[model samples]
Target: MNSLKTNYNIVIVLFVSIFSFQTNAQSAAVDQLHQLYIQTINTGDPGNLNTLYTDNVSIRNSDGSLLTGLNNVKKQYQATFDNGKYDITLKTIEEQDLNEDYMFVSGSFVFTKIDEPEAVQRGTFVNILKNIDGEWKIYKSYRYPEITNIKSIVDGLYKSFAQGDIPSVLEAMDEEIIWNEAEGNAYADGNPYIGPEAVLKGVFERVGAEHEYFKLDDIELHEMSNNQVLATLRYDAKVKETGKTYNAQVAHLWTIRDGKVSAFQQYVDTKKLNDAMSK
Candidate 1:
């Protein structure tokens, strides 16, 4: 009976050893795959890259466009290489093994134009890898720029404001954001609010104090060049002192950089605002 118990313990120990070995091997393979990808991008060579992805794999680009199939993915990469050479770097933020056959990996990447290293683009990516014939291959992939979606970022800010998420609204602004109100508007007294704190105290707070209910209407975001977004909207507000409502046409030109609003210039019908505030 003691001999049988000893054998059983040995079997358990062997099982644990085998499991640990498998886990370590999987981790090493995944790391190697990422390294290969970086090397391929830097060299502009598709060497063994076809083996990195599944035949039916799909990749989502920063602009929300999808590239389906391995051949198309390869062509896309070649096309990108044709346009310009880039030095790409990837860092894995998180990884999870979903099962024996699948894993999820997410990370951030920086792409620097080889000829112009100063021109760098930062983004995050997600990859779903499937194990086929003991080899892990990307089954699905997604990548998005950190600062490219100017219109979406502005839209999100407005949505946050509508939801009364003041903190989120302020968080979207850059540290040195140059905020300006329409020249003759009351808020212009504190034009060029230097930072988030200044804008919060000088503009947002004052607006909140002077209005019974303030809201934006008819917001149309226009994607402009030079990292700028032009928002054409109407300010719908009721002044607390005069109990009068004003729907003033307004235009906001927002300059964005590094995923933050760097500058804001407001153009509004100042006469409407002045009339609304007059008792």
Candidate 2:
């Protein structure tokens, strides 16, 4: 009985030791992935980015656009460097070892462009990486961004509106955005325009043509539950042909999904606007 006990004890010790070594190896492999990512971003080199991805990788961008396969991934990186000239850095928030062959990593990132004084964007991401033939690669990823940056998105869209950046402004809205103009307003012909293009043609373009200085001022944002943001502001504008000015109270109820404005409701003193138009 004594001999049997000793043998059993030895087997338990060996099992524990093996587990410890395997776990260390697993962590080391995962760490390599993190290091490679940092290196790739800092370098702005597609060659480095390509090394860490599998042939069939799925990268969902912050704007909810999915880039599949190695080619699409490479193109995105190349464009960011060549056109945007942006550099990104990441830090891990949590790392989980699903098994010896797979791992999960969640982290935040800061992106800066060459001309910018500071980082332009801060975002989060969760990724799944796998080991294939002894090499670890990013296989799947769900970027927790877009709305991960609500302030930047909502503020930027309004700024674009101010600048007459029509394309940029339209691109920030969802395809099927539910946009409404205040009733009794001249542009309220379409009560709830169904999409970005419709809003562009119906509301924005008409406002541009009819108003000499259409502007939003005294803006205050109140973030609400369920991913809603309420903006209270004043619309200051002059009717072009009528040569009349009005300062009307305005409230915009915005619903965001996947980091884009999916719905928008406008409340305004439409009578004041109509009176100005009559002038």
Provide TM-scores for the models: 0.55, 0.64
Q: Which ten residues in a row have the lowest lDDT in candidate 1?
A: 58-67
- Give each model's whole-structure lDDT: 0.90, 0.84
**Index of the highest-lDDT prediction:** 1
Error of 1 at 190 (Å): 37
Clashing pairs in 1: none
User: Candidate 1: where are CA atoms >4 Å away?
Assistant: 1-5, 147-152, 155-279
Task: Tell me how many clashing residue pairs each candidate has.
Answer: 0, 0
Model 1 clashing-pair count: 0
Error of 2 at 212 (Å): 9.0
